[model samples]
Target: MTGNTLGLDKILNALFTPYKERVPDVNKITQAMVAKGLINDDSEILNDHIAFRTLGVPHLGIASFEKIFLHYGYKKKSSYVFDKKKLDAFWYEPPYSHYPRIFLSELRVSDLSKQAQNIISKYTSSIITDPVDAIDLNDYEKVGSFFYKPLWKLPSKEDYLLLLKESEYAAWVIYNRYYLNHYTISVHELPGQYSKLENFNTFLESIGITLNTSGGIVKTSKDGLLKQSSSVAKIIKAKFANDEEHMISGSYVEFAERLVLPEFKSIPKKKLTKEHRRDGFESANADKIFESTYLEQTTKNIN
Candidate 1:
C-alpha cells in the first residue's frame, strides 16, 4: 500500500466540493445537527461512506471507477447484488479509517430491455476506449476534474424519460454522470440524543427534512446491527439536449448506524472504535436506501 493519504485526501475533497453545492440537504442536515447540538460543526460529523452510480458497460462502471481509489490504497471489502434493482455494487475500505468508505454501484445494462440498452449504448458506444485509462490517477487535479468531465452528450428529454420508465437509475446516470450520489453520516458516532438511527431520523424529520419512506422510515438489517435512512434526492433544474428543461432527481444525503457487535458490547464507549462495530453493509438495507432517488421518494420532496 502506498500509505499516502495526503494525496488521497485532496482527491476526495475534490469530489466533495461540487457535491455539497449540488445537494443543499448536505448543509441543511449539518446545520440542523449543529442546531440540535448533536454536532458542533461539520468537522465533528464522521463520514461513514460516500457512494457513486455508474453504467454497467464495457468501458466504465465499477471496472473503471474503482481504479482511482484502488490506486489510493482502498481495499475492496464486500460485494452486494440487488437483483430486483438490476444493480451490482462493492464497498471499499479506506487505507485509513478517518476516510469515508467508498460504495460504487453500476446498473446492469445487458439485463435491461433492448430498447433501454439501445438508449444507453447510443451515448456510451462513442467512448471507444476506457476514459479512466486516459487520466493520470496520480494527478489529484486531473482525477478530480475527471469526475465532472462529460463522457457523452447530454440525453434528450425524451430519451431520459424513456430510460426513467425502465430504470430510474439509468435516467440518473444518463444525466448526472458520476456526480457523487450521496455521502453518509455515521449516526452512532453522534451524541446520545441523535446517536441511534431512530432518534437521528426523528431529528431530521423535525428539521423539515423528508426521509425516504420506502421500507419504513428506518431500514434495518436482518441481523439488526445496521440501520439506515436517506433524505429524498434534491430536485434539480435539468436542461436536456431536447432544448427542454425540468426539475429532476439529483443526489441526496444518507445516514448509517453500524451497531456494536454482541461480543464487543462490553467495551467502553470512549475506547471502542469502528473495529468493534458491525461492519460492511446489508443488501436489504441498501436496496431500500437506493430508492432515495426514485420517483416515489422524491415526489414528496417536491413542493
Candidate 2:
C-alpha cells in the first residue's frame, strides 16, 4: 500500500511527463513565465495546484483517484461543493512544501438527470470493481498509467451531447477519462510583473493564447483573496462511437494568483510564507472556471 515505491519526486516527474506531452501549452507558458520572472535555475516554478475531473461512478470517482496522491504524501484538506454544477471536490495539501496541491472533483451521478445517468452508467457499468485496487499503488509507473488509461468504451456522439447538455463536466470525463484537466501556475509566487494574474494574463494574451472569459478576464473570489483564469481548451479531433470525427475541447492550462490577507501584507517580505497567502479554492470562482472546457467555449474561437 506504499505509494512512494518509486519515491515521491520520481513518481511525480513520471506522472507529469505525459501530461506535459499531451498539453504542450503548459510547458510552453511555464518556461516563458519562468524566464519572464528572471528566476534562476535553482528556484522552483511554483504550481498552485493540478486538477482532475472524474465521473462519480463506482470505481471512478475521487475516492479512487485520490489514492495516487495520498500515497505521495498529500492529505485531504478543504471540501468544496458546486450545487449548480453538481460537483463534489476536495483539495489535498502536499507533503513537500514546494510540491503542488491536488484538487479532485467528481460529478454527483445521482444529481444528474435520469437519461444522463443511464448513458454514463452504460459505459461505466462494466467496471464492476475498483481498478485501483488491482494496482500496486507503490509502483509509480503503473499508477501513472492509470491516469491516462481508458476505462471504458467510447460514447456515441448522441450520448456525449446528452451528457454535455446536463453536465459539461460529465461529458468531458466520459470521453477523456482520467486525463489531466488543468495545471495552475501560482502567479503570486512569480517575480515582478508575472506575480499578478492581471499582468500574467496580459502576457498570455500577447502571445495569442485565448483566455477563458466566462466570468471575466479574471475570476475573483468574494473575498478578493484568490484570482484565477484559464485559457479556453484546445480543440482536438476525436472519433466517437458513431465513427464520425469531431473537434472536441481537450485540456487547457489555468493561472491563479493567491494574495496575502490584509492582516499579513504588512509583514516583511522575508518573513512572509505560503501560510500567509489565501488558501483553498472558491466554489463560485471554480463554478465559472469549469466552463473553460465546455463545448460552447470550445467552439467560440472557431471560424
Candidate 3:
C-alpha cells in the first residue's frame, strides 16, 4: 500500500513509521506477523493491528509472542536489547509521552541466568543494585516486573510468561488493556507444544479450579484460546465479573435513573399534586427509586 492507503495500510505505516528510519523491510514485518500468526499468508497485505485479531487464543496473542522472539534467535533475558537513550527517556519521564513504547505487564523471571543478565545489561544502562529489585516481585511473592520500552527491543515470551504466571492478575490487566479486543487470534496456527483445550481443562481441575464455559463465548471463558488452557482464567474471571457489573451500572442504568429523578425534595411535592398529575407517577417513581437504590447499594457493597 506504500503508506498511502485509506485503510489498513495507513495504520500499519503509522505504527511502523517511528522505527522506519531503521527501515525494517517488508520481509521483517511479514516474518514477525507470521511468526505471531497474525496473518495466514506472508504475501497478504501487511496492514492494520486488527489483523492480529484473526488469531485465536494464545496463538496471535501472548503465545505467538514466544515464536516471534525465537524466530529472531533471541533468548528471553540473554538476548535482551534496547536503545539505551530511548529507555532513559521513559524511565525519567511519564510513560504516556514515551516514543515507540512497548508496555509489558508483570514480566516475571526468577534468578536471571548470567547469560540473561549480560544480554539485558548491554542495551539497558540501568544497573541492578539489589538482586531482588532486578526482577518483578508481586505482593504474593511472585517474581515479575512491568516494563515499558521501545517496541524494537521488547522481551521474549519465556521471560514474559514467567512474569505472567507469577503475577497472574497483573498479566491479565496488561493483556486486557493492550491485547484483548485489539488483536485477532488464529486458531489453526497454534503451536504444537501448546496443550489442547481438554488438557488445559484437566490442569485446571487438578488445581481445584473450574472454568465456566457455560455461556459458549469461548474468549470470555478461556481468554480466547480454543485449544489451550489459560493459567490465569480464575483471575480473568474475577476481573470480568467486576468489569461487567461496573459497565451495566455505570453506563447502562446510571444515566437512565439520573434522568428520571429531579431532586428528592421535589419528589414528595410532585406526589402531592392533583390526581390527574400524579396518576402513574408515584408508582413509576417508587419502582425507579427501588431499582436505583438497589443498584447503588450493590455497587457500594462490591466496591
Candidate 4:
C-alpha cells in the first residue's frame, strides 16, 4: 500500500504464512465463503486490519514493532487504553487505501502484580536494544523474517503458567513474540446478505466455527457504526523450554462490519466506497474482541 508495493506484498506474505498454518479457521472460513459465492478467491476478501501483541518493556513493544510498518508508510492514528485489561494500543492508517490497517497493542507490564512482572521481565529484560533498529527496514526479506524471529529465549512452563495466572496477554507474548495476533476480514465488503455481521456470524457458525462470546455474538460500537466478531483461538500444543508440552490458545481470525457514516448515508449503494463508510475501531468493541485468545472463549464447549 505504499511506493514499495512489491516489498510490502512480500512482507505481508511472510507474516500471514505462519498465521494461516497456526489458525486453520482462516482457510476454513475463506473456503466456505468461496462456496457461498462471498468471494471469488482469497484475495477478494478485504483485510480490515492485522493486530500484534507485545510486552511493554524497554527496547520492545509498540515503539519497536511499529517501526517496520511505519517505515512502509503506515501512519499511527488513534490511541486506546484498557484499564481493566492493562493494555495500551494504537491503530495505524495505511499509506494507501487498499492496504490493511494495523492495530498494535502492548501489555502494561507496570500495572501487573510484582510476581507477574518478574515472569515477563525474565525473558524480555535481555532485549537491550530495539531489534528493529538494527535491521535494514528496506530489505523486504529481512523485515519479513523479523516478525517470526525470537527476541529472547523461550520461557519455562512454570514461568508461562505463572504469567498466565496473572495476565493471559503476558503469557502469550512470552511464547508468541511478535506473532500476528489476529487478522480481520471486512464483512461489509461481502455480498448484501452477508455484509451485516449478524448474518455473517450465522454463516460462520453454520460451518462449525466457534465465535468469541465475551460481550455478545456481535460487539458493537456505542454509535453502532462499527461491529466486530472473532473466532475463538485454536488450541495448539506447545513444547515449552524444558520439553514440557501443553495445549494453549493460539491466534484467531476476526470479522468486522463498518456501516456507512451518518454524514455519508445518502450515498447510493452501487456507488458507495470505503470513504463513505465508518472508519477506525471502537474501544468497547475491541475490549471484548480481545477475548478471542482468552481461555474462557477458547475453551468454551462448542454446542
Candidate 5:
C-alpha cells in the first residue's frame, strides 16, 4: 500500500504538513513531507538516518515515525513503556522506596540543654542525613523544625491536568471571598516587628492588593481577600492550640469585622523553673540597656 493509504501515515501527514510549512527544518516535518510527496528527490534529502537508528527502526518513516503509522491502520503493537509503567518505576525507585521519604537537617542550638536535646531527639528519628546535611543552619531554620508526611508520589501528567483544574477552582473561590476572615499572628523578635509589617504591606500593594484601615482596624484589600483570610485562619488556629488560656474568646470572628492589624510582640509568662527565671531576668536587663542606648541616640538626632 502507498504510504498515504496507511491510516497512521494519513493522520501524521495531516498533523505535520501545516507544521512543516511554518518551519521546514523540523525533522518530523521534513520526514512527513517526504512521505507525503511534498518534498522531491530522495538524494536531495539528508540520508543520515541516525534519528531512525536510535529507535531500532531502519526507515525514516518507522521509529519516532511509528506513532503516525499507528494513527493510520498499521495493525502492529509492541511493548512501549506506558504512563502506568513510568509511575510504577517512580514509586519503586531508591530514596522513595520507604513508604514516606523524610527530609531532615542538622540541629543547631548554642546550648543543647537536656530539654532542648530531648525535643530534638524526638523529631530527628526521620532526619534526612545526606543531601540536606550540606545546607547551612540559617537556611534550614527558615523551613522550621517539623516532620512532613509524604502524601503521594510525584504527580503524573494526568494528575497535573487535574491539578490545573483544581487550581482554577481555588482561584475562583479566592476571587469571590467564599470564606470568612480570621486572625493570623506571626511571632518574631520585637525589633523586627514593625519592619516585617511594612514589608508585608508593600508585598500586598505590589500585587494590587490594598490595605484597608477602615473602622480604625487593619484589613486586607478587596481583591484576593478570601484566600488571604483562609491563610490567616490557619495561623490563628495553630496559635490558639499552642496557648489556649491566652486566646480571647470569639477573637477570630471579631478581628475579621474590626479588621484590626495584627502585630508581633513577645508574650510574657512566669518562668516554670528557677533557672528559667534567672535566664529571663538576664535577658531583660540586656534588652533594657539596648533600648536606653537606642533612645539616647534618637534624642540626639532630634536635637
Candidate 6:
C-alpha cells in the first residue's frame, strides 16, 4: 500500500477511519467534548494512546502486531502483567512529542484450559511463520494496511463462547483480530471545567454514554496522577464460521485524563510545561478499562 513515507497525521486518520465507522459515538462524543470545553475546533483535543489486544501464540502477539507502530517511530516503554486475567501488555512511546502512545496486550493462550487452548491453537496454527517479518517497514502505507489484515480464519460460534467463559480478552482477539480495541482521549489538555476526569465523566453521562464501572466510574492511580474511563462496548452483528451470525460485543473507545505530579505544582500555571503533565499508562487504571468488552458489561449496552 506504500509508495512513499506518509506523514504521521495522515497515517492516524487512515487508521482511525474504520474504527470511527464502527463506533460512531467516538466522533460525536469527541466533537461535543471539545465544544463543552470551549475549544474552538476538534484539532485542539489531544489523544493519549490507542490500545489493541492479540493472542499470544506463534504468529500473532506483541512481537507481530507491534512492528507497524515501531516502523512509525514508536518505542517500547513499560511492561505489565495481569495474572488474574492471563494477559501481558506494554505501552509504546512515539517518535514525536505530539503523537499518541500505543498500548498493546496479548492473552497467554498456554494458560487456558485444554479445550480452550485447542480452540485457539486450531485457528492460529495456520500462521506457521511470523507475518510481521515479511512487511516492508519503510513503507508507511503497507504498515498501516497490516493493522486491519486478518491473519487467521474466523472462530466457530461454539468455540467463541467457550473461550469467553475462561478468558474474555482471548475471545475478543479471536474474533476481532487486528481491530483497534480503544482510542484514549487526553482530557488533561481540555479547558477549565473539562480538565478533570470527574467533571468530564459527568458530561459524558449527561449525553447517555455508559462507562465501564468494574473498578469505579473513575479509576485513579495510587498517586492520583492518571485517571481513566471507558464506554461499554457497542454490540454489533458478527458473522462467525459456519455462516452463523450473532450480535457480539465489539471494540470500545477509552477516555483518560492525566494530572501533573505533586512536585510539579511548584511551576507557574503557564510555565508548568508539558513535562509536568503525567505521561504513560497506569496498570491499575488500564486493568479495569479492559473490562469494557466483557460479556456482562456489553449485554446491557448493545448499540
What TM-score does candidate 1 reach? 0.98
Could you tell me every candidate's TM-score relative to the true structure?
0.98, 0.92, 0.18, 0.97, 0.16, 0.94
- Return the candidate ranking by TM-score, descending: 1, 4, 6, 2, 3, 5
- Please give the lDDT score for candidate 1: 0.91
The residue-by-residue lDDT of candidate 4 on 72-190, one tens digit each, is 98999999999999999999998888889999999899999999988878887878888999998889999999999988997899998988888888888899988999999999988
Weakest lDDT window of 10 consecutive positions for candidate 4: 1-10
Please write out the lDDT profile of model 6 over residues 1-303, one tens digit for every residue: 222235566668767889989986687787786666557676776878888898899878999888777767788989999888999999999887677889999888898899999999889898989998888777566667877887888889998998888988888888988888888878777778787888888988898888888899899988888889989988889999999997788878888877887888788666665578787877888889999998878876854
Q: Which candidate has the top score in lDDT? A: 1
Q: Write the per-residue lDDT of candidate 2 for residues 130-211, one digit (tens) a residue.
A: 8988888777678767777778998898888888788888888999998888888787877777788999899999777888
- Residue 106 accuracy (lDDT) in model 1: 94
The residue-by-residue lDDT of candidate 1 on 80-184, one tens digit each, is 999998999999998888999999999999999999999999999998888999987878889889999999999999999999999999999999999999999
**lDDT for residue 292 in candidate 6, whole number 0-100:** 93
User: Of 2 and 6, which scores higher on TM-score?
Assistant: 6
lDDT of 5 by residue, 1-303 (tens): 122333322332343344233322234323543554534532333211000101111221122223322222233322222221110000100111111111111112212335433332333323333222332322222112211111112222332233223332111111211111111222111123221334434433443332333221233343311111111111111122223322111111111111122221132323222112111011111112111112222132232
Error of 2 at 213 (Å): 0.9
Assess each prediction's global lDDT (C-alpha) against the native: 0.91, 0.83, 0.25, 0.90, 0.22, 0.83
Clash pairs detected, candidate 6: none
Q: Tell me each candidate's RMSD, in Å, in order.
A: 1.1, 2.2, 23.0, 1.4, 30.3, 2.4
lDDT of 4 at 71: 87
Error of 6 at 46 (Å): 0.4
Global lDDT for candidate 6?
0.83
Off by over 4 Å in 5: 1-147, 168-189, 192-200, 203-303
Off by over 4 Å in 6: 1-7, 34-37
Model 2, residue 72: distance off in Å is 2.1
In candidate 4, how many clashes are counted? 0
